[model samples]
Target chain A: MTRSVFFVSDSTAMTSKGLGRSLLSQFNVTLSEHLRPYINTEERVDILLNDIHKTHIEDGDAPIVFASMMDEKLMNKLSQGFAGVIDIFRPFMPTLERLMDKKSSKEVGQAHKVGNQHLYQKRVAAIEYTLATDDGLKTTDYDQADIILLGVSRTGKTPTALYLALNFGLKVANYPFTSEDLPEFTLIKAHLENRHKLVGLIISPERLLSIRRERRALGSYADPKAIAAELAALNSLFARESIPFIDTTTRSVEEIAASIMAISPT
Target chain B: MTRSVFFVSDSTAMTSKGLGRSLLSQFNVTLSEHLRPYINTEERVDILLNDIHKTHIEDGDAPIVFASMMDEKLMNKLSQGFAGVIDIFRPFMPTLERLMDKKSSKEVGQAHKVGNQHLYQKRVAAIEYTLATDDGLKTTDYDQADIILLGVSRTGKTPTALYLALNFGLKVANYPFTSEDLPEFTLIKAHLENRHKLVGLIISPERLLSIRRERRALGSYADPKAIAAELAALNSLFARESIPFIDTTTRSVEEIAASIMAISPT
Candidate 1:
C-alpha cells in the first residue's frame, strides 16, 4: 500500500514541507504528499487528525506526519492519535535549551514572524530594487545592487535574480545581452564597475531554441544557427572577462541560486 | 558565551538553514549563525571542521552544528569530532526505511535536484507567466492563471505574486487597481469570468504613503488624503463584489502568500 505523507505545522507548513521533502527523497516509496498549514487552533488540529485517520483507514497503512508544530498540547494530542508521527524538529531542542541554561519560548510561527521590521523592510526594498532594475532598466543604481546577473534573453535570468532577491534579501539586477550586442561586446559602465558581482548565465542552444520558440513561435529570435552563435560568443565573452557563470539548461532555479549564493562575494 | 551555530550540509544548506532557524527560534540564545553549503567534499569538510574547532576553543564552548549531510561517512566523521552535532534529519530515516521496506538512497541535494523535468519546466513556466502578466499587462490571458491578485499601488501585489509563482509553481497574474479606477471599479471580462481565483490585496494608507513616497519624493500619488479615499473606496468595491482581500500592511511576502495558498480554491 502506498503511504500517505503529510507535512503539518502551526505556521505556513513551509519548514515542514521543505525539510520533509528532503527527508522523503532518501526513501524508495510510492507516497502521496499533502501540506497542512495553519494548524494552530484545536479546531484545525481536529480537522487534520480526521484526515490522517481517514487516509490511514482507507490505505491500510498508517499515514506518516512530518510536523513542525510548536504547541505542546497540540503535539501531544497528535502523537497520541497518530503512531506515524515524526517530529520534524528532532530532539535537539532540549539539548540546546540545557546548553544555554534557558527555556524555549515555544511560540508558533516564530520563523516567519516580522520580529525585526528593519530586516523585513530591507527585504521588501530588495524586491523593489530588483524589479526596478529588471531587464537592464535603471542601471544607474547598480551600485546599490548586492548582485548583478548577465545573460541573453530567456536564459533564466529574471527568475533567478528575483529568486535571489526574494529569498535571500539580495538586491539583484539582471541585464539582458541580445545577439545584436555581441559583435561589439563592451561592458556597460555599471557592469564594468561591478565586475566583482557579475554572474553569467547560459543555456544550451537547443534548450534555448525550445524556450524561445515557446514565447515567439515565429521570428529569427529562435533561429537555431543564430542561437548557437550567440551562445558561443557568450562563452568566449565570459572567458575573456574572467567571470563565473552557470549553465541553466539542466539545473533548477534552486540549484542555480544555491551555486550563486555559495560563490557570491557578499 | 555566545554559540557559533552552523547550518552545514552537502547541498545548498537551505534545508539545514530553514529547519535550524526554526529549531533555534524556540531557544533563547545568542547565536552567530553561518550557512555552509556544498560541503560535499572531504576537503570542504576538513575546512568546515577547522572552523568549528577554532570556534570551540576560542569561545570556550563547542560550536553547535545543524547538519543535513546525507553521506554516512561524512556524518560519522562529523559526529565523532563534534559533541554538539545535531542531525537535522533525525532518527526517522531508519524508521521510514523499515516502514517502506526499502533502502534509502542517501543522496545529497536530492530535494533541489531536477529529477522530474516536467515539474521543473512547469515552475519556470510559472515564473514566465507571472512576469508576462505582472502589473495588469496582458489581461486577456488571465484565463490561464491559477490565481489573480488585485490591488492598488504599493500594496505588495507584484512581489507576492512573484513569490507564489517562483516558490510554489503557481501561474499568478496580478493586476493593478489605481485610484483612477475607484468609481469605475468594474471587472474586465477575463477577471469576471475567473472571479473565483481573484484575491484582493490592500495596505494601510500610512504605509502606502510611506512606500509610494519612497518611490516618488513628491506627488499627488503619495498625498495622504488621496490614499485614504482610495482605500475606503477599494474596500467598498471588494465588499460589494464579495471579493476576499488580504491586508498586506505588516505581513511579509511569505505570510501573504501562505494565507492566499490556504484560501485559494484551486
Candidate 2:
C-alpha cells in the first residue's frame, strides 16, 4: 500500500520547484496539496478538516501531513487535532532557525562571497538565454553562459538548468517541444544546424505518462502511444544532431546535470 | 601554443568575485583590473594602456582582448591605441541591451509572479540543516549565503558554492579540513551518527597541491606529503561515515555540482 501525504504551505510548498521531484518519484508515495498565503491557522485547520472529511481514507490508510507555517499556536492545535488522521511533518522550520543562528557566529569568506556572485550571474544568464531565441536553443550570449542546456519538458530541464545556474554559477537555458515539433525532420532541422552545444534528455514512456497524467487528468496526451512516439522522435533528433542525450526516465535531475557537465564545453 | 587573452572589467564586470581566477586557470587568460565603475572614458583608456604596458605585448603577442565595458569611446580608444595588439571582446553588453529591451514587452506569467514559495522554503530548510548543530560541515546567512554550500573544500566546493549564491537567489557556505582534523575521527563520527547528511567532496592530492600552490606560494603545508596524508584521511572518513563523495580534481565547479546533485540524498 502506498503512503499518502499532504504538503500544506504557500504556493511554494505545493510545487517541487527545487526539492528534486524526480528523485521523489521513485518512492511509492502520493503527495497532495492545500496551499494559500492569506489563510490563517484556524482557517487552515478548518480547510484541512474539510479535506479529510471529503477524502476516502480507509481504516488502515497511512497519510502524512507536511506544513510550512509561521503560526506556532495554530500548528500545535492542528497537530493535536489531526494526530490520528495524519503524521504531521513540519520540515523546513527547524532548518530556518538553525541557519539564522549559524550566521551570527561566523562571516562567510571572500571566496564564498564570490561563489554567490556566480550563482546570481548564472540565473540571470539562464533567464536571458531562454528569452534570447524562440526555439530556446540558440544564444548569441555564448560568452555569458557558464552552461546552457537544451531538451524537452518534464525531462528535467528547468530544475537542472536552475541547479547549474543557481548552484554552479552556470547560465542555463532550456526549451520544450510541442507535439508539432515531434516529427523527426522538424527536430533535426530545428536543433541540428546550430553551433551551440546541445544535451538531450530522454525519458521512459511509462515515466513520462505518469508525469503527464499527474500534470492534468489522465488523457490521450498521457497515453503510451503518444509517449512512445515522442521518445522515438527525440532519439532520432539526438542521433541526427550528434547531440548526446540521456535517458532520464529513471534518473534524477542531479544525475542528468552531472552527465551534462561531464561533456560540456566549459 | 596556448592563446593568451586578457579579461578586463571593473567591480560590476567582476561578477561573483573569485571566478576570475577559475576562468584564468581554465584558459590561458590574463585578467586585468580595468573594470572599475563610474570612471570616465579617459581613465578607462589609461588603465587599458597600462595593462598592455605591464604585459609588454608589443602590439602582437595575442590579437584578442576581452573587456566588459560600457564606454564605447574607451573601447574605440583602446582599439586605436593598441591597433594590432587587441580586439576587444565585450560579450555582455549586446545581450544585456537586448534583454532590457525585451523585458518591457514580456507579459508576466502566473508562475513568475507567484513567487516560488517551495524553493524559498527548501532553501531555508537546507540552511537550517547546515546550521542546526556545531558540526563544522556547513555555514549560512541570508546575506551571506544567497545559498550555503555544505561540503569539504578543494572539492570544487568554494567555486561551485560561490557560483550558485552569486549567480542566483542563493547563499552558499563551505568548510575545509586541516591536518589537525586528519588523525581525529571524532568529527566525522559525530556527524554521521547524528543523521546529519554530510556532502563529501574529494580531490586528487596532486591537483590539491597544485591549486594550493597557486593560492599560497609554495608553503610547506602545500607539500605533496601533507596533501596526500590529508586526502587519504578524508577518503577514509567519507568511507567510514558512508558519506557520498566525488573526485573533482579534473572537473570544474559546474561539473562538481552536477555530480553532487546526482549523488546527494534525494
**Over 4 Å off, model 2:** A1-111, A114-119, A130-148, A185-190, B1-266
Which 10-residue span in candidate 1 chain B carries the lowest summed lDDT?
Answer: B112-121
Docking class of 1: medium
Q: What is the TM-score of chain B in candidate 2?
A: 0.46
Q: Per-residue lDDT for B142-182 in model 2, tens only?
A: 22333223333344554455343322324444556777776
The 10-residue segment of model 1 chain A with minimum total lDDT is A112-121
For model 2 chain A, the run of ten residues with the poorest summed lDDT: A102-111
What does candidate 1's lDDT look like per residue over A118-158, in tens digits? 55667778888998999999999999989999888888888
Runs in model 1 lying further than 4 Å from the true structure: A1-3, A29-31, A57-62, A114-116, A182-186, A209-224, B1-3, B28-31, B53-62, B183-188, B204-224
**How accurate locally is residue A112 in candidate 1, as Cα lDDT from 0 to 100?**
60
Instruction: Calculate model 2's interface RMSD in Å.
Output: 21.2
